[model samples]
Target chain A: MNILYTKNISKSYGDFWALKDINIEVPKQSIFGLLGPNGAGKTTLIRIITQIIFADTGKVHFDGREINEEDVRKMGYLPEERGLYKKMKVGEHLIYLARLKGLSRNDALTKIKYWLNKFQITDWTDKKIEDLSKGMQQKIQFIATIIHDPSLIILDEPFSGFDPINVNIIKDEILKLKNKGATIIFSTHRMESVEELCDHIALINKSNVILYGSKQDIKQNHRSNTYTVDYIGEFRNTNGQFQITDQSETEEGYIRSNIRITNDQSPNELLSILIDEVEVHAFQEKIPTMNDIFISKVNEGTNA
Target chain B: MHNIFLIIQREYITRVRKKSFLIMSIVGPLLIASLWVVPIWLSTRETDQKTIEILDDSGFFKDEFIETSSLKFEYIQTDLVEAKTEVLSSENYGLLYIPRINLDEPEGITFFSGKNPSIEVIQDLEWAMKSVVEDIKLERSSIDQATLDSLKADIDIDMINMTESGEKAGSAGVATIIGYISALMIYFFIFVYGIQILRGVIEEKSSRIVEVIVSSVKPFHLMMGKILGVGAVGLTQYIIWLVLSIMITTGISSYFNIDRKDSLPVQTEQSGVIEEEQENEFVAEMFNSLESIDFSLLAFAFLLYFIGAYLLYGSLFAAIGSAVDNDADAQQFQLPVTIPLIFSLIVLTAILREPDGNLAFWLSMIPLFSPVIMMMRIPFGVPYWEIGLSLTLLIAGFVFTTWIASRIYRIGILMHGSKVNYRILGKWLFMKN
Candidate 1:
């Protein structure tokens, strides 16, 4: 089931279109990647969905009803511009934010404590936010954002300040939220994280979606007409029937060569010939990763 | 509504818990009370009103003034040389020599104290010298002492201001004095606390904590909370000062009754009958002044004005807070908000002179100035319609300002680094979003 939807949503300031005709759907219990470079309408969409800024021309529907004020109570938004009351203690600040999200005071307190302990920052409860380092503060902010147990979580660049270990911790928490049937919109430029976490993604460029789909589908759609073969019987560095873009011989006397089909011969025909000539070990098609797809899509967009 | 309450609670607790607020709340009233009470006490306790002798060169007036415990007068022969010599050598505090005056000419007086004569002594000697001149003229006209005494004594005018209500007589000066003070206190607390809310918002915005808090609650709630919370604190301080002032003023008045003759003024005087006519005029002056104060009305009016004025300006200050992004920008908004408050105070003070006049009536009806002007007018007897109308306007003004401020707060808060001026803010008000 679709948990969140944006249909032809666009926001503009005078002449600059912050988000232009953006359309996307967040499925339930999925960690969806919202991929964009800086200034690519990601934050704009986030603000609109969070109801902080109204869309210039579009509609947002959460759980099949038109977005209204009370919908924010069920949504958690962690903005790119992070802020906390520097004079206030970490635990108190989290609880306050939680209560603002419509949790009872007691419920907020319990959740804040649980999150703080789960994040292993239990000792930081009494410490002022200003006294904490940037990473620690980021952790506190992260805990505050999720402590309400919001169903629809929109995080914009949530991993900007985290180290590798903490990044994995947050990644696990995000996936855990997804496992708990919460739909998540994780926006960032880190393609490696998209590969690891996102089940589906929408790559936006210049206020337009250049490519979007399930991670597997998007990558598979970009595969080139190339194939690689590994055989034990016979294969030369340079081939006559095919163009060997590159080749190498293994220590076990098996030859691995990357072959680009010059003619419109099918993979099966090439495989039969390979089977006839040499003892076939492995023959597989190469598929593009999300990083390659993202770059190529951005460049393709610029060119188009 | 609960969110607003929470916001208000946060505002009150955070601010009231501060050491600065706690210290100022206690110290402000203490300082004001000390100012009101200490000087009066010090003046009464001094016991050193220096006595000076006058040597009038006007041959028509040659009597020494008088002599008593702290004062002495010596009549010198109409010799400037002898008087100057005596003044330079005598133990008397000063020699006030009034130059001979043709009844038509202004008198040129000289003070020959060892040092400069105090202003009070010089002024007292001037009043006394006038009497001697009048006596000489009476003697010249062959009027006997009995007729002269009767003529010179002020005929008490029995003022009867009656219109089917009981007749009451009051000194115009005392009424005006009370009216002026009532108006001024109402003005002071409103502007003081209103600006406090503005300054506090600027401080929070400058530190960027507003963004954090904004995420949790609406900016309108935060602005209203701060204004109401600060106003409550300010009123608390005001009540403390009022109590302290009443205690000290009443305590000292009872402790040192100047009329009891034990106050030392009577002891310092040469005689009870400074002259028979002088005694009668002084008694009439005291009774004439005491009838003007309507303490009950004064207290009642002050409460209404205090609450109304604080809410009126506080709501405006809250708007000013939301209109600006930072303190530097708040200066522009500050002038517009504070100008009305200060102008109201200025107008209120002026109306004290004629609280029942046309200017006071119109100003009292105005929402911005009414809280203060009405307070001043109350001492001079305002009608029920006037108080009701003025207070109603003040309440309405607060509600209107609160709505406007909330709208500004909603838009301005999310915008950062963008300078919002009058033009932008004005447009923001009309924009539907």
Candidate 2:
């Protein structure tokens, strides 16, 4: 079931259309990767869903009903340009933000303490935000985002200012939250994280979603009907089953050749032809990475 | 509503705990108290007496100078040069030279001193010589001094204002002073608290915390919270100053045994019993006029106008702050917003000249100028309906400005790194969130 979704949402700023007829659905308890280049209307769409902004002509649904101000309490958003009050203490800042999301004071305080201890930053509670390191502040901001135990959490470029260790820590926390039945919408340009963490992705470019689906399905659909084979013997020819697109000699005296099926032939048929002529050491099909798909789709959009 | 309350709490607590606020709160009352205390202290304190030597060439001015506690006159038998040298050599204040001249044309009289003599001393010597000359002229014209004295009359008019209740004594002078002071206070508070709202908004926007905040609460809530919070801070400071000033003034006055009647500079020996009696009467009349003012009504109107004016301007200032990236960029927008306030202050004297004139009436009805102009007119006794109309218009204007400001603020806070102008701000007001 979908936790949140937008249907034909469009927003414009005077003569500029920041978003246009955008449609996206985030399934329950899934890590949905909102992948896009910079200024691809990703932030605008997130703002619309958070109800910080309104779409000109469309509907945003939270659960089964149209979203309202009260429904926003169930959703937590960490904007790309997120910040905390520099003069405010960590504990106080968290409590304030939690309370703003409709948590009672006691509940806010209790949740703040739990989150701070869980993140192992309980000692930094009294420290002002400006005194903390960037990564530590990012951790505090992360705690503020999820302190209310929101059902749907949206994090935009959450790993921008963190070290690798902190990045992994946040990643683990994100996965833990999803395992706890919270849907996550993660927006980033980092393709590698999308590959490792996201279950579903919707790639938007130039105010439009160009590609979207489950990670496995998107990779499956972008396959080029090509395969790479490693052989130790001299590579001769295929028996009219496939065509060798490229060939290279490995440093260890092995031949690596890229082959594409020519006549609707299966991989088994190509392998039988290759086994007759060459010693087949290893064979694998080539699948596109999210990075490759993102670049190509954005290029296609600009060209169109 | 709860979110707005939270925002206001944060804004108020953070600012009130600031070091600058504490310093201003403590220092502001001392400054105001000194304004009341210093003048009376200076006037009652003793001054060093000065002696002047008189060289009379005409020989008609001998024994004409009279001595007072602060000044002493001595007659010297010497030439003008010799008298000046003696006066300079001794510890005397100056030398008064009455050159040989006709009594009808007294033009060559001069006072030579090492430094400039105080105006009071010069006026005293001139009066002494002129009185003697006038006595001689009166005798030569065959007129008696008693008859001349009877011809001189001092006129004092008592103003009586007829109200619904009855006739009450009024003083235009006292009303003008009270009106002017209250208007100035309103002007001062609006600027001070208005800028505070602007800076608060700028801080939230520049720090980029507004996005996280607006995602949870509406931008209108945040803006209203900030404006109200800062205004409460201003009110807190004002009340503290008022209490502190009254306490200090009364404490110092009682300790020094200073009475308003005694604080008046009464030079009995120099001015004689007639002028002293008149001075006493003037002070008594002023106290009576003070009692005629309706302080409760004035206080109520002051609070209403002050808050109404502040909210109106405070919202505009917040809008300006949201449009700009920093204080430097706020200058272009601030000028237009503050122009009406400055204009009212500039025309304050004109309004006071005729409180019921057409200029004052029209300006008092306009929401922007009414806070000041209407305040200045209130002490002079404005019709109740006129004040009601002005107040209604002011509230409507406040509501209108707040609506405009909130619209601009919601969009402006999210936009960054763009050069904003009035045209862009107008576009933002109509743009969808």
Which one wins on lDDT?
2
Name the best candidate (by DockQ). 2
- Return the DockQ of model 2: 0.80
What is candidate 1's CAPRI-style docking category based on DockQ? acceptable
Supply fnat for every model shown.
0.26, 0.85
The interface root-mean-square deviations, each candidate in sequence, come to: 2.5, 0.8
Looking at model 1, the pairs that clash are none
TM-score of 1: 0.77
Candidate 2 lDDT tens digits, A135-249 = 8888888888898999999999899899999899999999999999999999998999999999999998888888989999999998878889999887666355567888899
Each model's lDDT: 0.74, 0.89
Model 1: per-residue Cα lDDT at residue B145? 88
Candidate 2 per-residue C-alpha lDDT over B1-433 given as tens digits, one digit per residue, 9 for 90 to 100? 9989998888889889899988998899889988888887886664457899888889888877766656788888877787887787899999988889898998788899988999988888887787889988997898988888887787889988777877788899999999999999999999998999888888899988898888899999999999999988898899889898899999999988987775667654445466568778879888877767778889999999999999999999999999998999999999999999999999999998999999999999898999999889988888889989999999999999999999999988888999998889989988877
